[model samples]
Target: MKYSLVASLILQGSLVLGTRDLQPVHFKAPSALHFRDIVRNDTYDFGCRPIAHPTEDGQFTLHALLTESQIAHLTEEYEDTDLSIHRPSEKRAAAATAPIGSGDRFSGGTIAPIGLGTKASGSTISSILNVKEISSAVQGLVSTYGVTTLNLPYKTFNGATQFAAYVGAGTDKSQYHLYLSAGVHARERGGPDNLIYWISDLLAASKAGSGLTYGKKTYTNAQVKSVLAAGIVFFPLVNPDGVTYDQSSGSLWRKNRNTKSGSSGDSIGVDINRNFDFLWNFKKYFDPSEAPASTSPSSETFYGTAAASEPETKNHVSIYDSFPKIRWFMDIHSAAGDILYSWGDDDDQTTSTTMNFLNSAYDGKRGPVGDSAYKEYIPSVDLTNIKTAATAAVNAMKAVGGRSYITQQAVGLYPTSGASDDYSFSRFWAKSGVNKVYGYTMEFGYSTNFYPTLTEFNQNILDTNAGFMDWALAAISVGLT
Candidate 1:
């Protein structure tokens, strides 16, 4: 007896495949940590804010942005006691005094589109609208399916809620479970658009192909509906406050608006990504002043006052905790074509097996090891030779003309704390006692800033959604079923 496997490409509310069978395949996780040094250097540079010329007393007034602990650590390591440090306030004032139009200044940009496309007049492919409009459009496709909302409350913003919509078999005995989310970072244009279009297409396709497509490789309309019927929840925007702030105030807003720290001005929010509980405060380099003002409120890269301090972070944690059956979760981002995996905060010293799994999944072909002399200076996780499954997914995506790279946390491009993928993995291990929960952070598209040409933007969304769903479905087929 041959069992047929059907995969549905759900975007634009349409079914686009026939049925096929699951082939015997071997998958291994990645072991090597590449791009670690580059990330480490970036983090270091973020801490190093060069000083202006000499101060009033003819002494060079250097501003050390590092925390007290970081300063202490550096001092002990390098024995540089002569260095003077400035407080967060002084730094803020200095930054403010600098001209906004100055090339050296870091001006917070905007993510809002300069023009709005009317529903009927706008191109079907690219148009960034409010959440309400996106939601209304999706309702047309999955109206019959039960819709359950997860109201994630926000404290910083009055009565703000992070929205999630569930469609499929109602939380009971669903064969294939999938969780879809976008806009974890508000500035990413692809997040919201991809989510809305994917849902719409999935529904429309399922309706049109009810019985036309079938089997393992190809999905029939019925199979597509069954997958949806099995249960798929869509969280369109995870960081509502951050996204709203990005649109209205600053395009560079990466954290939530929650003021956990007691400081006023510049340092007014926590990098919600760095506010998770696992390996909680493990900074690659020691930086005490890096700590948020009140341990609650922060300006940038703030790791909340404590674990789960921000409501947005809590909302994610709660969702993962409440749903044990959620086998797959993807936290979407943009600007980089990356599909990052678990243990992001720090190295998972205990879980070498997980690292190996990731390595193999990524098909570990070591890059040029750029500037080998500088390689040893990089920080990286020590693991076996196996490649990461996340990397494999990225490679597969890349093989098809998708640009991607596997990077270590704190050592690749950016070092972050309290990420959703890390949090979800921890929660999964705790709840299920099994570390099979495959979570990823997908950075979609490189050419497009917040607003790319509609055609290019739409295609990028389609390709990414396709690649993601394909890998996800394939991974699920191989691992889960």
Candidate 2:
């Protein structure tokens, strides 16, 4: 899909031309732009948008078509600010001031403090895992577990390359009953981290003397061994193209890279989250022209030319279809401290008992009480008692730290469409006759203009990993028993 060229006049003396490509378009400013005015007014309307190319130079050059006044405003607003745009007071407020101690035998260095070590090695597997490499790696895991790999086909945005992969269970296919995936949102820093950490933890726990227990629950090595005895199917980086674009071109990129024909040549990406098949067109019904569109290739909320148009989306769907036993699913992302549930559009809808069960297993059975600052900034939805796997994970993280965080649907922050969790839940309910599919969207932490320092980055990963381990093992215990 490709878009026609278009132009629009801006508030001040600025002309905006829309073009499609991986590289962002550059606009020259006549004078210095002010930052204070821009931030106050939300100039540039900077959220997430699509770009033409995936390169550092390509990203740095792309400019939002803000007017001279807006540019001037932003220049001044961000000139002296650090990458995070976080004020010193805000940083201090968000910081964990109280000391974190390991209880009893768990005290001292044995308890790894946040960001305790150098960032974990091999965080950039996306750079290494191409279609061929990913396929080979999955095959190796499948072979080791003595299971059959379900071959699935997918198509890319360019339509030039096709993606194929195999899915299967562990050594004893009957025992290994879960389907696993991560990196659904290419732009999120934690998506890849979650995948890497998950695999590492699973492998370590599989070893004879790893001593990794499933959270607070006491599971014998034999039981832990039984859980691993039946293996999992993983698709770590489903959207490689988007991931590459995010890392190299723009941090705010959110959508498949497919181009489409449209009025504003500028808008040219589909919100893959809104591209799923369930309640899929809600965005179109509400905003119609703005997003969730049946037409308009350049729309950020484009629901694909039709459902499953993008290869990446289809590949994931195929994974679900092939693996009937995938009782649990999780799609990881970052920045938002949220764990959203199904029926994201409304708060009154009822979720399955299994989903509710897992939600409790994951989110400590209670809603969070926001911190002073967060209470002031966060809305009520963040405090809602929603049974969602994502919220469960957030509650677990909070339990360990004694901090309060939000848990609700993604729509509480912003409305999204075709999200993987939504799709997974719908499918699980339809197929299993039981909502055994406990799906979640884990938002790690903020990592936009400012990437976390090495310490902050490491801490975020470890905290999330520990939280997920506790949640996963507990859920498994409930399911098996």
Candidate 3:
């Protein structure tokens, strides 16, 4: 808390966040007791702020990207405490990571990106979709499945016109109760592929009246029809410009390609995920000790100049206006295997309705983790529905026969502001007469392993597709209307 506040003051001068050539590393903390203090630093980047998972013996393992200097400083400080840091090598990263696709895989929208679930067993995806392939795959979906695509009103800084699609909902936009999206973070590769392929599986299975199998987890023809009947509205590839830069430069870029903030280096773009209107002005809504989102442009989680400032964020928000009855939403991302629920800016509470995000009574008093000051109010029914749906998705991911996943509230070890999941859920209370929507984030793949190997990429598709199936099924079970 002390370090974060001091850093915040220094940032008042509009200093650019310091840049570094960071490498992913694992820190085995002595226990969650020690891990909590370390994560509260706010200076350290625990990718997506997931809780440190337990090791077989008893210790907790945390993943982060750190510069050599930061690593050295922490090493010196925590050497006596047995806080061990281990560098990972899937044969030194590059060798293991699947290459980004060089040319159009979808043949300029002529062919759809078929998912692994629809193919015979032992299928594989050759590479991560290139920027062009991302669009072409979406085009293929429209061409092949009769999906409706609408051009989002806002154009990105790079002059790209973004769009979103809706399918399996017949003609009425309001019938689209379930929403799934991806490519919010440029370097979280395969997220778009995971969502696109899952859509294809649903369409194909519904057409053929056959079952869908993702490894050991299988959905019958009836289950497939039921999920499709729930309706799906998806915006795949939310940040096109960022994905373009990340794909071309091989940099771990996580923001839009907007240079309004700064012209060069890390000063280039805004973190679109952190630009949502929910608690966007973290300095006003959160406590001094909490750094939910950074004010520095060069920081990866920069909240941007204003809420919904970026055109991409506006396009994302525009979806709710178009499809007002959306009851469930899931934003897809990678490198952290978690299914995150609502209340990212603080802990969730069922009793304190007046202390919620929509209530100005708790301004400047929120964001502390274990505190008595304020807690975000979520009704008991809403909490049960979200948790039940999250658990179903997590169990389905494990049943895919590849890996395991956990479901938790979005605020795990630290808080965040303007995140998509929180903003989607907060809409009900923040705006009058808005439909009640349950929001979720599916963080797939290995921790900090942004560029998964081809094997892992294919495995990720299977794991997440099964997860989507159960998530949507559970959402329907809980009630879509």
Q: Could you tell me which 10 consecutive residues in candidate 1 have the lowest summed lDDT? A: 19-28
* Candidate 2, residue 476: how far the Cα is off, in Å: 2.2
By TM-score, how accurate is candidate 3?
0.93
lDDT of 2 at 153: 78
TM-score of each: 0.59, 0.59, 0.93
State which candidate has the highest TM-score: 3
- How does model 3 fare in lDDT? 0.86
Cα error, candidate 1, residue 14 (Å): 44
Candidate 1 lDDT by residue in tens digits, 304-404: 77777777777776554455467666777664455565544322344233332123332221111222211111113212111244554455455444344
**Residue 328 error for model 2, in Å?**
1.8
Arranged by lDDT with the best first, the candidates are: 3, 1, 2
Which is the better candidate, 2 or 3, if ranked by lDDT?
A: 3
lDDT of 3 at 338: 85
Query: After TM-score superposition, what is the CA distance of residue 467 in candidate 1 from its true location, in Å?
Result: 2.1
Badly placed stretches (over 4 Å) of model 1 are 1-124, 137-146, 153-156, 171-176, 210-230, 262-265, 283-299, 346-415, 428-436, 447-455
